[model samples]
Target: MRFLQNLLSFKQPSVMRRIDIALIVAVIPHLPYLSGFILAFLFVSVIVIIYIKKVSKSLVNTFMVIGLLLIFISFYGELNYAGISRFSVFISLISAMLIYVVMLQRLSGRVNFYLLFSPALLLILSFFFYNTIPMLLYMIFAIFTFSTMLLWSVMEVNLGIVLKKSLSLFLLSLPIVLILFLLFPRVSFERASYGFTNDQMMRTSHDGTMSIGSDALLVPSQRIVMEILFDKKIPPASKLYFRGSTLYSKKAGVWKQIPQKMLHFKALQKRGEKTSYKVTLYPTFKKYIYTLDYSQRALEASKITDDHILLADKNTEKVKHYKATSYLDYINAEKLSAIKRESALDFNATDYPQLYTLAKALQDTSTNKSLLNLITYFKQSQLIYSLKPEIDENSPEESFLFKYKKGYCVHYASTFTLLSRALGIPSRVVTGYKSNREYVYKNYLIVRESDAHAWVELYLDGAWKRYDPTAYATSSDLLPKENQFLNDLSINYLYLKHIIENWVLEYTRDKQLNILKKLLEDSMFAFTFTFYVLSFIAIVLLAGLYFRRDKQVHPTQKIIDKLLKKLNKRGYKKDKDEDINTFLTAIDLAQIQEINTLYHKIRYARSSSTDEVKKLNKLIKGISSKNPKYP
Candidate 1:
């Protein structure tokens, strides 16, 4: 029974027990992918058990220690799996837990209510020292947690006067902080301090081939990969194309990018008008940047290779904004060089014998240009269009052509390019996102990964003309309006994520210095310094105000004053301006005798005394501590 009573004692609640409960809740969402939901249910069951068992103090303490060990173990496991050390996370958790335990144990019932909430105060300070969170988010979370703790302490400790005064001080400090944040001169260093590499790009889509016996296709990833921004009148959603790599070679049933080679644009000058736009591309974990055809000029610091595609020398870790100028009316008719043509048309005759025979039969029926005939046949065929394609166990290409006949842009473009090459037409596969969703604030079209597509570009009439074999294969409603809405939401999300990456994650010394230089040049540095000084002064003033208010007579002191007044009304009046001891001696004989012994005991005590003076203290103690007559 004594052990049970200790477990239920509010003054001595086990710190480890609280930590155990918190750890169990925090780790439930991070279980193995397959077991996550099951583990969550099991954690909930544990919570129920803890509640029902009414665990003893010793058991609670034991569980808390076990929980701390498990938390450390989990942190190490995360470090191992992530291939990065989480020493800071481990240290912060341990420090926070230790500080919490110490504060709870040593400070209970001794300090003012705010002082008893030292654990929360230390946690806020930890966030600042750790630098594990964004400054803005850290400040917000700190304020929120601190405010919540303050409110809870006020309710639990009945510190209404302190709460009111603290709240007033907080309200007075907000405007000053806001003013400082806005006016501060931001500085950057010459060298960039932070950057993201291509390794961070979250790859969500697979290449042409699919692995057997794996659940690769159904692996759901919610990561937003890229955001595109375009200037000027928004292009029709159908005409928006984010052009990427041109794959002209296939070996072992896998599409490979052809080596970069120049293609002459004979009718480049024919375009009376040109459209120049900027693309703020997110890192796609691939080198290629999608742009329209016949690109004549690229922005500074970007490389325009022979294929008229733009490539950035630096890996695009965040949203990379670049300008591309493309001709709207240029014709690409430089026929493929003999070597290139042969390579483009090259395919293993023995591997796909049936496909080759079918292509030859179709070739014999065409009287016009082989490329034109192929294009016409594909546009006029009964091949269905669908995102879901049936994979054949025996032969994928054969099944796609003869039986299933329905697939995405990849299937259509792959089949078309291969068959065109068989019919003596040099064709290449181009992969990129098609269509853009416009954002209101950016005033630019945003593209997404779901818009990833494949099409064919054939060498024709002295230039390469784009031919989307899947264009005709897809109906207008193939992508539902709802899908487009979701795509829009995804693009917006990516844009916000890009902003966070650029402004927070990739914020570096160079950027900071640049900002400082700009501020100095604009004569804003003086204003910033003044603002900061003024704000600091204001905070100091507000803090002083709060301290002064807190230093006033405590509630216990008020009760002592009331007791003195009551004694005076009962004819044991203190002399006007008399000292406390003199006032006690002046009381009537009966009253003096009643309170003198108690007053001596309280006044000359070696340790700290309660607010109650000796006379009232003895009476209250007798009634409350012994007889309980006050109740």
Candidate 2:
């Protein structure tokens, strides 16, 4: 019973508080990606740790119970989503045990050896979740804190000295770390994507299908979806229709993409000036790749479908970068194949009779006039645009056109395509993203989930032309106008994310090979430049050595050295090769004995509450020849 009491009452060492702080800092980088269960646990755990002593024991117990429940819930949730993998389970168990030890520290104040390694593990695991410049910087800071704990345990130096040495060690090792990173054999992205979160499979926007009038769906997210950099100035927001996928078949108020085996790769006729750009896409774990309107050709990493949709050969859940050339004004095809025409025109008139009659009534002498009249009809409908449109799902198109008269982009696109088919004008729905008025990042456009949109493509005058029906609606629902300053910050973050993603997160063997090939092409020039840089660095270092001053000893050590010489001059002098402690012991002078002890304490202790120099001065003034106490 006494042993139990002693164990529970044991206090933590000085490094424990810093360890807690480092763990908290490590969790910040994951806040944007973590699930609510994990975030809640972290938030509550932080509170318990911060106010552990201030709060009563009952409150601490309550917090502990809640944190444990959350951990169990999160563990089970991860297992279900990630499936039965032994490695995953083992890592999860290790993480749980670490957290449990940390919690016990708050409750019992017992020193935990397990926590000595926890901060470093947290930083390593954070790499698997996010790889960005800001995250890398925070990890470095956390590393310094971890280094302090290790240095303190072994060296037992002063606090300032410990910090300085930690910094020097990290700086000395940085070059080797970079060399290993550059030379390491990286696994292919498809085989070794970092995470196992199931959210990648569930795209929050542009899922290649639409059923707008169904029960209320997931709330829209404002998180960034893609960041695009154009070689030229970005086009107006009205012209930024970055297509991701195309949908054709429809039944029971749902529009879906039906793969056309007969419609093979076909070239798009370029109309206006071609613009080239790079796109950095966030993970959707889907095959569809986003491209600007009327992509000129297949991207290097993907294939172009008949509808000009870019399709990656395989799915991935990592941030992807690709270059594409596109013309905002272009003809999808001069001649539509029979298979595509059938796909575009196949719609049941009986299912939406009201919309079909409306389509026939709006027909005119020419296809152009018919399309114009259809646009005017929509403009006059006085329909409001909303995310959650109150309409019947059974006959969504008919209900939207004749009764409810209100819906968002998906509803407008679906209704228009059905009506155009009814009027003998072949049409298909395109699902993608569009940037409205907002601040651009330099020349790049940062597209978000809020930019997800749907539009229609009509066969007009021997070409499939773009038509957005939502443009005619009265005030569509949109995210509120964000502050310009906040938007600029977001844009800045994307700039850094892109910079790091290409160099580190997405660095592959193919990129390295390409770099080496370029280097070989310019071998002579590269060798000359390298020689000049090295010569310059050597000169600067030599110049520094020529003029730099010698180093000095510590202030406290100087004072003690002065006192030891004075003591030697008096009759208390020493033997040959005698240490300071041995000389003090042999003389047995009680007055100055404390001076020797204080100096060594200053040199050896890990941390000191009072100034070692101040204590030494106090002892010196009274015990030395100048003191009034001896007189």
Candidate 3:
């Protein structure tokens, strides 16, 4: 009976326990985003105060106030937009205050209840910022640790028992949480006056006009521009040219796209060998879809220009999906009008006399092989391909061709177009993604942002033929060879990333509906899902029951626990960090000293005889009898 009363009694949390709770509740969320200065400051402060003194309640309160002030100042102008930050700040402040309050004052029922449950709020907030798999693993550990601490804070219990109960509670709640998440109605109609509500939702910047002759080097954007889900066959890297826009007007060395009205779109007759695909495009804040070469739009409200480049009907600030079909290993046989031919062949001839002299000589040397001669010249001309290309802004074309000679796909494309036009061959620059390499998952091909490329297209044999001079540039030792191991690691990382994004993060309402439809179609899958869910629930309940069974305790441990409880009721509460000897010494109690000596033998020296257990229990009973209120 005395043991039962001791087991159910409340106790003050130790200094270490209070600090642990405060640190977790106040600091963990900000860990990922904390500055180096703040971390160093904290480290220095900890070292300075290590053995000087115990943690002061005043110090904790001061820090809490400072944190609150910083939060307010940081979010001064953006309070409306900083709702999440505000929530985190408030929780941290309350947790810190409660922890310090516990240290200085007696644990009132209200205060104890709030302290017990406040950390749970931090756990919920954790999900808002970090819902990734790694964070999920961390959360499991955190939930167990904090919940165990909470259990210990409120009641006098064995450490192992506290751990077991915490685990049981967490597991028991998991099934119900999952059930609620699945069955919860997320979509709702806002209002009705015959008016129902509708549901709604930079990953990359692809909207900027792809200017031709700018001396500024192209920065490689690894930010994903879009993802492609090929309906059928995935195109090879050599052939995957995602045509965006065609630049026809060239003046002052810079090439610009002709106005929308100036370009013409002819119907594509070669649909027999078409490859159908869907594009899940990231927001570029522009309408450009960056569709495949010779692409024809298959979805409504999608636009395809004469250049075979697809676009959304409106600017998209969010992810938008569209379907299109593109022909592979086929020429765009649409004959260019005389005006279009002139536009394609147009360039500033007066500006490039040196280039024209070279072009005319090549044209004269090989009349029938002008295009091939020009391509061979580019291949033979030791021009380096790089992200950071050096070209004089005043003479970008001349400097790129004759002087610097090092450039990216843009340089290769622009120079090749100028040379082709100089030779009177109809040519223009096409800027889009060259999504050659891709991760193939579940019959879908994934293309990322690094594939953004520019190339030239020349009119040959009554059809526009794609000429990738950048491929020629790569054939030369311009760029350093990629480390095979690093490349493979990167590919694997991307593959895993796309898997997570598609199956986890991007699993939308539509995907859920499709999954349900499939489950309905297959009775076996539905049955399997239902059976697993029910089994999970049953297993959770059984596990909880198993863990809830009476935990076996050593007789010596029981005696020590009873003694601690009796002392607590008599206003000689032992510090949680205090060992049996230290606590007894602090109390200066002769009776506790005898129990402490016996406990040490059983706990440390392996002396657990029945006589020792009875003796320790006898000492505990004497203490309890003297302090009857404790009993």
Candidate 4:
């Protein structure tokens, strides 16, 4: 019981305990799958534990809990659609939080030992538990989180001392790191692409075949997946149709891509003035990339496939930044061949009976121009644009024509393509992201998956012309005009993600080498080397200063000083302030018995004399060695 009491009363406060709590708070944002309620309960319990143990008080705890809860709740809508992986993430977060708390309590108040080693321990344990997760990602999170904890611990222990030192070091290293990043020799090594592959597989738009049900629901995703930057000024919005795959054939209510072997790219007769632009694409895992009608020249990373469509070298997993130069006029001027024309017009009339009848009726009444006019007529009439359109049991196209006249970009684009094919006009569905009007940041345009769109490209008078029936159907929904607050927040978040992707994930060996080379060339090398040497010297100096501050005289020396002062006050004079060995020879054993004994021990003891020597030696020698008659 007494030991327990002492342990509880241990004067040193546990800095690790506080730090663990703080880390938990910081990590909650990343655990999207975890139920907010469960996390809320756990967080509250931790805060209560801290308060009960006198680590923190009620008010601060309440505010923290409330604030974190609000943040978690705000992301609930997104979480619902994010799928099961998010839930697994929450479980891992809970495990991490529990481990942090247990470890902190065990360490007590020894903050430095805990601060430096806890992360390493956590990283080891994380692997045992989260073996399924990628080690690289885990390492990244561990390094970042632990580094933050270390910084916090350093500040707490040494107050502002560590910060000042670190800042000085950072300033010295900054220029060197920058130079190395810039001037490093770059090699074009193949990089593994990253993005939502499952999202791509599930993506109906990428396949070019669109159903009213699936396509309608994807309209409001609003998550920007890629960004485009032009070397020159961005092209006009009307000319901006980032092309994916061209769906040349529709059979049995499905859109079909032209076989790669059958399709071929023809060189332009006279290449027009080429405009170069770079597209930083978010991975859809789909082969096709949207380019303006024809590309005269492409970067080494990209290839011109059939239909003048651009295909990346490999599937992308993340944001892929690649450059391409296109001759916009040459592509616009190319005539559609018979094979292309036949494929675009080849729709199975047997499968879509009503669509076939509609086409026949239009053809019977009017010419090719009238059939084109009919598309505008249908879009203008009663069709409404929406994210969630009413899905029916019958054929989706027939449903769109008869039932819910309302639909999204997919509905309009799909209907328009089918109608054009039925009217003997060569047309196909083009799928890719649409333009985002809001300028997100410098040299980047935010294109969200919700910006995923489908439009018809009709081969008109020997040239394929872009036609957006959905744009005509829903002009009001083109760009978000209202709800400026949400819009701004979303755009800002996307922009931050863009920067992280570009700066960190895309940071190559070339970039690192360049930074190092630049540092060498810049004379910053001298400054850096000098700074490191000075820093080492300063650390040693500070350590020496602290050591001196903590220094104390030995107990034996203190005792001797006190005895000498006492003897002087009593008028017992010693010749020259003699050393212990010389002074002991003259000191009378009978007088000042304890002092005489201490002096003998100091002069004769095998080991250096201390408080133990004074105490034990006086007991042994005072009675026997001192003559009591003189005292």
Candidate 5:
């Protein structure tokens, strides 16, 4: 029983408990928006503080400093993150700080009006990231919780009365909220409503850099990257490679593009049937465009580089709708430039002496060939393909080549490029998605982040050729055993997501304007205009009715409230729990003790005579408007 009481925070002040409830409700909506680490930290911190009963100020201060330092370090690390991403994180951190302060039991009794609204700001911030129907409903509930508690704290009312009043307030204002939403001007924001809704939604996978051997589990994202509409029958599964970027420079087990110099507007040589398609890319917070391998032409490209990578003028903070013609099989850079060749072949022999020696050992003596031998070696390497590969920091290629013989696409691609460069082949790493599901939707294809892959592009003989060592990986189990029920659920979810994105979240300013125009043109608009006029009349009548019987309340009470409001405006306000005499003296208004005495006497010392009333009124009126005046 004691544990249950503590768990429910029953010992806390009633107002404080209400505030806690409001704070928790406001924070719950941000779960999908916040990272797992921050969520876990917040959970443990709040639980520990709540259950410990007594928290030292020093301990709270220490944790506060630690949490702030963590936030500062994170902000410093992700300086290049999108502005919206940074702003959301800043708001989230501030919310955490407020939660800490509220849970500290420091203000359990003396409730401040500002304390109630602090959590309200969190609900507003959350809507900026996501406004799904469920989220909208949750936010509505959070608003009600805040309203009910705030009214209870200020008024001397029963729980039933408080709840009724709160509901009445919401019900009364909902019509106005609807009217505003219908007529208010809307604007486009959140080209990405969420950062990966940063790095958690999508990933750093499509970002310029790709690392081979990090000791982290490789979990795939189901977030749709792009939906493509093929002009004809979609290409074969083996040919559905949507290229993002070409990486040549390898440093510290990471592959990255060489210099911006490697990027150019020169076109690739055409050699096969071209498939034209329109790409509707979602927000990646990046500037690169994805297209089929060896694009013939990208209509929206600022530059179609020789590496077959497309560059856009601005980051994909907004949806990109463009068309491109591409060839699944094509020869690239038949006459590879000397500079490009050097970059592709650039590698430190000292770093991978083992890989270099192995490359030489694989050279066939009779045929004097290395390419076929390399292919055969990979086929016979018996390398298992698993997303959860063991880390090999010092020598990733060496470990994969001889010791562990286990890795995913990145490991295989990175190692293959290194070995190719060692064998005097001008080769580079390619990062993109190999979308091969039989999924289709009205002549369009949805490419998911799970299809993200890395392969090799080597300038051999006369042109660049494609090679995916992952295809030869002996054991590949990147997906789980087939679960028909689970797969059906996933498909339905994706379909619903697509529908919401098109009809609601992605409903743009133009769509809103079009809707407004249609409504205005309709005959029912006459009723809408009448309703607007009636709403105005209703507001004015309500205001008049409220003040109609103000004479019933004594003038003394009104004067006291007016004075309190003035004092509050000037930052000389008194606490609700403080006595008038104490509050007045604390603000150095001790010279006006007569007002406090008269206030008490007027209420407690029976009916005042007319003369006494006039004298008290005159003395109170004697106080100056600018500064206090004594009578």
Candidate 6:
């Protein structure tokens, strides 16, 4: 019990209280992504102050001013902007000023008020940076700690009691806070648009570019760019080609795509096996919106390009939720025009002579025959699937196909597209993500950036069909083992992350309305929601009643009354009009005088010292012994 009491103790020295306030303020401005330098500075500064055993108020004030100037200069770049960065810097500056006020000033009514208000301000500022459940709990704790400190500065009371009162007050205020938050107005926008702030904050792992020969080594990434919640079961790994864009032009082994006019091509609607799904895409700062094989219609606030790629009107700087319907065996049955066919088949013969020679040898009279021959030719080769493939920069195509015969999906896709174009079979390189490791957690599918993939789309038999030559190679050997403990742990982490995102970060006004609409659609849900709201109100009312119950008598008053009863029993009946001094004079005893002094200090001066109470108890016993009739 003693150890537990000590563990819950809240007593601290004067300088330690100031340091605690400073440290709490220091932590608030850097949430979600705090800088290491600032954290180290706060710790080191507090430690040095404690070890020195003395604090010169003037010296502390001077250093505070210097710190403010240095902070301003350090964030001068952010100050020039009109975004979240600038807002964060402004918040930090305000926090610094408040911390100085709390730490440097001596204990007084004014200082107590400042100390109480600083942590609340910091808590409010924290909402701008993060709004997770953990942050909400931390905010409540900040309030409780500062409130306890405020009470301690003014009243000498047990630490446990102080903590109890502060915690009760915080709990009682929560319902009101929640109500206000729900009814507050929020900014609304229909489309996902990324700004400079988003770029500065969250960077995409792999840039959405389909160029080739840029880097010899391909680094594997595990970042999650998007997650899908399908209306039905997920498709097979072989058919999971999230089409982002198509690269049709090639120059010196580097494939690139020209910007096509938005909404130029009429989407040909052909009924087939289709899967409807909703995507929760993170901020990519790019225009492309990845989808499956073919999408018949564009997502809301987005458009379909001439290359049949879905694109947002602007960059996706926010978490975007959009629905898309994709056909499993989608065949773009629209016959390519003569001009389109020539453009798709056009490639620089001089740039890829070795590929051209191979294409010439493998060409057949028919388009299907030529495509089959090329795919067969690749399968017959000894090329292996590798994460990082070594190729000669000057002759990448020749090195990859003839010498090394080991490259990644990009090499295979680029090589197949070039060879098909050379053999008069129009083809384009498709770059997007492929999900082999699809985790089914509560019906939603989670896919990571390690699934980023590349393939070829050949225009055969008046329809575009997908081909993946890399699938012919041993691609599984290049990736990590499945069903391992780490994989299971990863799935668990993703499940938790999904809950946080859906419940807190992406809970926008539209989503709230959607939730309400769904709740109202079902009788049980409506009843449950209404019941919850009413229960919350009832709880608040009950809490108010608990606080409003009649106050008990003060402990000091009870102790004084017991002493008076003992005196009355001893035949020294106190006059009703006599105060403590008059009663003590009538008694005329040294022990009674001492008891009277202690009683007056406690009852009149509002002191509650345990030592004084003990002395009064001893003095009362002495009086009782002097008069044998005392109770």
* C-alpha RMSD of each candidate structure in angstroms: 11.8, 9.9, 12.0, 15.6, 18.6, 8.4
Q: Which 10-residue window of candidate 6 scores lowest in summed lDDT? A: 191-200
lDDT tens digits, residues 1-631, model 3?
Answer: 8776565342446745554465455447644543343444344444534543554656555644554455455445545656535654444334333333432222121245555455565566445445354565667677677767767666454555676677778888878886765555445322111111111126454543555455445556556676676767677778788877788876655667765531245665574577887776766677777767776543467766666766677877656666677776566776677778889988676877878888987885553588778878877887777666676776676777789877778778877888888988889888778865644554455566667777888887787888888887633333564787776677666557656655555555666666678788989999998999899999988998788777656446766777677677777777778666887776665666666777788676643565776777776777653755432
Better of 3 and 6 by lDDT: 6
Deviation of model 5 at 353, angstroms: 3.3
Q: What is the lDDT of residue 258 in candidate 4?
A: 73
Instruction: Encode model 5's per-residue lDDT on 212-315: one tens digit a residue.
Output: 76733468767778877788877878888888888988776777886554344555666678889877687787878888887755454467666767878777
What's the lDDT for candidate 1? 0.54
The candidate that achieves the highest lDDT relative to the unseen native structure: 2
**Per-residue lDDT over 339-401 for candidate 6, one digit per residue giving the tens place of the 0 to 100 score:** 667768897788788988998999888878888898888888878887767778876766888
* Candidate 5 weakest lDDT stretch, 10 residues: 4-13
Candidate 1: C-alpha RMSD after superposition:
11.8
Candidate 6 segments exceeding 4 Å error: 1-5, 9-89, 100-112, 131-137, 140-209, 214-216, 317-321, 337-339, 348-354, 438-440, 475-479, 528-631
lDDT of 2 at 94: 54
Q: Which parts of model 5 have CA positions greater than 4 angstroms off?
A: 1-202, 215-217, 229-232, 262-265, 278-282, 298-302, 317-323, 348-350, 364-368, 438-444, 477-479, 503-631
What's the TM-score of each model vs. the native?
0.54, 0.66, 0.63, 0.55, 0.50, 0.72
| Candidate 6 pairs with clashing backbones | 194-317
Q: Write the per-residue lDDT of candidate 1 for residues 311-367, one digit (tens) a residue.
A: 656545444555676665667555466767777777666766767887776775442
The positional error of residue 316 in candidate 5, measured at the CA in angstroms, is 3.6
lDDT of 4 at 469: 83
Candidate whose TM-score is highest: 6
Candidate 3 Cα deviation (angstroms), residue 295: 3.7
